[model samples]
Target: MFRLAHISDIHLGPLPRLTPRELASKRITGYINWHRNRRKRLFGNILESLVDDIKSAAPDHLAITGDLVNLGARAEMDAVAGWLANVGEPDFVSVVPGNHDAYVPGSFKLACRAWRPYMLGDDKPASSAGENLFPYLRVRDNVALIGVSTAHATPPFMASGVFDRRQARLLRTILRQAADDGLFRVIMIHHPPVRGATQSYKRMLGIGRFSKVLKEAGAELVLHGHTHLETLYRLPGRSGDVPVVCVPSASEAPGGHRPASGYNMLTISGGPGEWNCRLERHGLDAQSSKFELFHSEDL
Candidate 1:
């Protein structure tokens, strides 16, 4: 069996600290608003606990669907890179950028450059025909991991995302190739493929098109992060049912009760066309510093 662990939305670093003058003048109002709603300062320790938990579980591969930083600040990106380095084993971890990771213009590219060393898979050849925003195809012994960046910086209060035409087309091609190559394809992205589950204002803008491509390609499983809630939804495909699993944030607390911070461990067995998967949730107890199984989904 092959085991894959999926987690997302670490949002590392504390709230931005603006200069007194800037704050007083409302020059940094955006930062202030974000801080007011974000998890205050619980992310770092929570992430540490999560990493320890993942280490113990020791999945064959790790996929992080995005929002590694809160505002795409350079310092936050650096912190995120450091944390990933601390938790990730080379060739085992892969990530895709989320909307927050591209908070400002050009920030997504910057984060990709800074975090490239931790990215898994072979370097693309010069003639490769995919969007180069860390969009990659990774071949593990038992699975083919295809990652795509759906991150885009939108206007303030607009958290919508887009996959762009290039990435969208490339994704179709990659999925077809992987299927022909006889690998269990797992597509990872930051935004959920389903629509209406998200707030109407912040929904993934081009999700319809994205979903169409995915359904046509017939991926075995799809994973996304950004909802900050644990959810499982079935998307129809030509071959059969495709499961899209959305993991809650590893560290987040907007209000009310904080959902459990954990990751999904997926075990796949049997050959192509006869494959089966069992998903188990592994969570960390902050007080005890121990990891335990929180839930399971039979698939």
Candidate 2:
């Protein structure tokens, strides 16, 4: 069996000192939010514990769906790169950016560059695709891991994501190619594509187009993390229901309004027409101050 571990929304903390210029735009709002509220709920220590647990589990591969930084600061991105190095090498970890990673204009480029190594596909070099490489495919064993970016800069107080026409077109092609190869396809995005999974202000746009692509090309599983809550939903595929899963922020401290930080361990065995999947959830146990299994089931 192949084991894949999934985590998201790190929101790595201890915000670096921002120059007046850096906080002059949309970042001002996020900075205020962090200082007033977010920082209390998201802790680096919690993230460290989660990572340690993940290391002990030692899944064959790891997927981080996004929000590595809170305000999308250049220094934050640099720090997150260092953190990623500690997590694992780029080849073993796959990542996609989140709305906060693109909180301000031009920040998206910085995130893409900083996290490029983790988001790259096995088949194509990062140099060849430059910054436009979305729907990247990494073929591992009998699985096809596809990474798609819904991250985009938005106005203040709007934490929305977008899957534009270009991304949709490429995603369709990638899904088709993976299906043709008879591999179990897993699509990774930062935002939950299912409607009502997020508030209206934070909703993912272009989901109809995305659904159409899925309907035509199909995928075995979809994973995301932006709502800071655990979610499980299925979208219709021609052959069967596609499982879409989400987990809470990896850095979220216990006793928050949202559920404690957690991650998913997915075990897949067998092949295309006769595949088997077991999903195990690990999350912070607030009273015990440790991470433990909170849920488990077959999907």
Candidate with top lDDT is 2
The candidate scoring highest on TM-score is: 2
Per-model TM against the reference: 0.89, 0.98
Worst 10 residues of 1 by lDDT: 21-30
Q: Clash pairs of candidate 1?
A: none
* Every model: Cα RMSD to truth: 3.1, 1.0
lDDT of each: 0.76, 0.90
Q: lDDT value for candidate 1?
A: 0.76
User: Candidate 1 residues 1-299, lDDT tens each?
Assistant: 89999999887767556455434432244576666766563456777777877878788988999888777766677777777788875587888888888876767777877777544446565334313744688888868888887788777677778877777788888888888887888989888888777887567777877777877888889899988778898887658888999887887532436565778999988767887889898766655655678799777
Question: Would you list the clashing residue pairs of candidate 2?
Answer: none
Please give the distance, in angstroms, between residue 271's alpha carbon in candidate 1 and its true position after superposition: 1.6
lDDT for 29 (candidate 2): 89
Clashes of each: 0, 0
Provide the lDDT at 139 for model 1.
Answer: 86
